[model samples]
Target: MTDLQIRATAAPAAPGTTARPGLLLLLVLTGQFMALLDVSIVNVAVPTIRTDLHASGAALQLVIAGYTIAYAVLLISGARLGARFGYSRLFQYGLVGFTAASLACGLAPNTGSLIGFRLLQGVGAALMVPQVMSLIQRTYTGAARARALGLYSAVIAGGMAIGQVLGGLLVSADLFGAGWRPVFLVNVPIGLALLAFSRRLLPVLPGDSSRRFDLVGLVVLAVALGLLVVPLVLGHELGWPVWAWVALAGSAAMFGLFGVVERRIAARGGQPLIPGRVLRAPGLVPAAGAIFLIMAGFAGFMFAFALHQQAGLGHSALRAGLLSGPVAVGFGLSSLHWQRLPQRLHLPLPMLALAVVAPAYLVFGVILRGGAEIGFGAEAVLTTAGLAAGCAYSPLFARALSRVDPADAADGSGVVVTVIQVGQVVGVALLGTVFLGEVSFPAPARTSGHALLVTSAAIALAFAAAAAFALRTRRAAG
Candidate 1:
């Protein structure tokens, strides 16, 4: 064989004499479970937190927004950090940081402190989450990779479902009269267990010799995201102050500057924080737009539903959580048939399924508003949303990834994930703002149930628009 061919053949596979797909799945799933669970676990605790900390609407918003903003900002940087220091090392350090931050959150005496600790917790999560996907990428190949991704997606759906359930149970249990504290404290043991298991189970990947940290890019990205997201989250709560508008304007300019800096870095033979080429992909832009719309609508619907169940119906945390289980069930069931659907039908099949499912929320709102008490009966809406999500998520993801070059997988994935995060942030901010603003009208006359019905209708409309867009894209592509 030629020298180049020999070298290619001789490149070492990932370490450990034997690697099992099952073990790798276990390790990666555990990490993903922790990361995604933390995202929505706090939702059920929002009321208790407001009471305990004597926090305002804005404070509660911060408690959620702060963590997400920090998490999104650090994701790209964290991936690079893992590459430089070794994924195993970064993953271990992240576990330690996450556990400690969770403890700090549990101990926090006030909303401000809790928000601060949560931001740190998010930093740790950002460090850890990218490694899970990277590890999967490094460990598995071909058909095995596809199977692993399927399992990973299932775990994500299940974990999100369980997080809400667990959050509700912890808040309702009030073990030690801890109230909302246990919601955070529960992470400690899980984090420790993951750390121990991962040390033994995860295979170490070789570090790149040419890797260099992009400090300037990191700073610029952080500032740009903060400027954009912070104002969107807090602006309405603060009554859209003058400074908020300025911050929004500044975000646009900062993002432009970041683009310029990235181009310059690329020209200088350095990797930018985000490669410009990935953003230029035609499929990525539309795919991201669809993701953003879907996420925004979903977040808004869930937030409004949670508030309505508790405040309007006087449901316990556990009860509210149980009411949302149907969505999870639907998602789980639909995912089972997802791989088979595209092959049998077409690209629009899943989107059509989701379209049919979207109106269930509207029906739910009408029922609830018509004096139907919130209980397991609300499962109709949950089921519809879950089914829609299950059918839509994978197909959308596959379409996006199909357009990506094999060599650009990591960067493309990062961009997709970043857009997902951005979509989530925008959803929570915009929808929450609308719900809060609308509810304040006519004071006590506007019940949380009414507010929720309005929000649900709005969400349903948004999803309908998204479904239409997806259909259009399908036609164009065909």
Candidate 2:
């Protein structure tokens, strides 16, 4: 056997007695929800953050996206850490640290400090979030595992919605005159409550000694992402200077090197960050790539759309945040409804979702293309997009892991999530950068409109990728 073979033994629920698996699922979902909330919670508060901190456009994007960058970079390593230590052990620790980081973010005196704290929050999130799936896989079998994953998807979708609403309401309420800080401070009580029960509720699996941590692979991958993102985020502000060009080139080279290093590690019979096999797995590569493109499109559109509402339409932060709430509503409805669906049918959900979303985007494009004023019709369009995303996500997770062995759940979950974060960074960086280039003060509707067209193209690509993956997987099953 090649040294690169990924192997692990998972201990499911206690043999005779059904462990209070419900509580375990609750704990996992709670942690996952909190982490996912941070991703969108700040969207509502972005303008407030910018005004209060005197942040530049680049600084604003960093404040919002820094968490994702850190989370993506460290996730694979964090998964290995969970394997080495224990999933429950890491969950508790990560929860506590995450809570503290939230406090720091609320109290941050400057933009730099806030961004730094947000990155730390990402680290804390990365540590805790992967375990939710790992524990679910470890504690449940068959039907229950499917339910847990569904609930996880529901929480994630619901959290994004709730975050936007709460962020707007909190900032508008101006509680204790805290303003944008409450969006972050709200995590403290929730994290502590989750932490208190984690020890008793979560299963404590023995560390998998067989999995090796490849630090060199981690470093190169980090560098690769940094190079790719830094230039993309900063290129517009810096007028696409020589340094940005250098960074872009270096990022491409670093990514290539990262793959080489990882392949070498696997060839040497050692574990690398991402299993060499996972990349080569049938239907997996295209699915992962599609996810990246779709998220980039989705996230970019959301960011740009938010900016348009606030800056161009003269909407208040609360009002602007509420605009995307429909998407969340659609997502929640679809995911919760799908929980009862048959397993065999789940794989084709994404392909089906694209059919729904394609027309919606075209309509949204036409609306934005109009020379006259657009009304609340845009909300309807966004809600449709949200519904499509919700439809896609739940099934997407299940389908991607369809070919993966249950024993390798930890690594599989980590790899899937890692790609998600990377996709997010790409979305925010490019969209935010592009949005800034065209959006001038006092009326950015035209520029924002143009950006939505770009998003349409990205989403179209996502649809194609999904179609390819669906075809490949369907044939494989047959």
Q: Estimate each model's TM-score.
A: 0.90, 0.91
Please give, for residues 244-307, the per-residue lDDT of candidate 1 as tens digits.
8999899999999999999999999998988777667545666566666776776676666667
Tens digits of per-residue lDDT for model 2, 189-268: 99988988876787768776777789999999999988988888778877899999999899999999998998899899
How many backbone overlaps does candidate 2 show? 1
lDDT for each candidate structure: 0.72, 0.74
Per-model clash counts, in order, read 0, 1
Worst 10 residues of 1 by lDDT: 1-10
Candidates in order: C-alpha RMSD to true structure: 4.8, 4.2
**Model 1's TM-score against the true structure:** 0.90
